[model samples]
Target: MFALYSGSLAEPGDPNPYAGGESLVLPKLWFAGYRRMLRVRIETGPAMQRYRAASRLN
Candidate 1:
């Protein structure tokens, strides 16, 4: 995890070493409600539609 944040895992010659990082520090106020926003997006997103369709077929 430390390696990822520090861009050590990125390819040696790549121009953007930290291109795909998925972790960061947010302000306390922003951090508090971020997950709820993500949860709502996931529940209503196209992936949820695909999941429901597959479950019905099963």
Candidate 2:
């Protein structure tokens, strides 16, 4: 994730290492929310699958 975020995963000699950071810190804040959503999805995925299966049986 860090490599991808830092653009190290891109092809060599890429000009831009990072994007959307002219001066403000808005992108960091947005990334924080995105990480939180991924965490929640991972934590709740099994429970959600179970709920769907049970609902289908009703």
Candidate 3:
């Protein structure tokens, strides 16, 4: 039910397309490693969300 777009660029065809007139180019090999890092951060980020969700449970 959750739709998330992390690596989404301006152009669908190009994975690391230009952004704000600046060229965005990330090595394909590096992407695999980068993706894994981002995945871990995202999954662990829920804890930050939960703490903020409650303003001191009272």
Candidate closest to the true structure, highest TM-score: 1
Clashes of 1: 0
Ranking by TM-score: 1, 2, 3
Shift of residue 49 alpha carbon in model 2, Å? 7.6
Per-prediction TM-score to the true structure, in the order listed: 0.45, 0.42, 0.34
lDDT of 1 by residue, 1-58 (tens): 4433334333333343333455343222233344444565678889999999999998
lDDT against the true structure, per candidate, is 0.48, 0.54, 0.44
How far out, in Å, is residue 36 in model 2? 0.2
- The Cα RMSD in angstroms, rounded to one decimal, for candidate 2 relative to the true structure is 9.6
> Of the candidates numbered 1 and 2, which has the greater TM-score value?
1
Looking at model 2, which ten-residue stretch has the lowest summed lDDT? 8-17
Clash pairs (backbone) in predicted model 3 = none
Residue-level error in angstroms, candidate 1, position 21 = 24
Superposition error at 26 for model 2 (Å) = 0.4
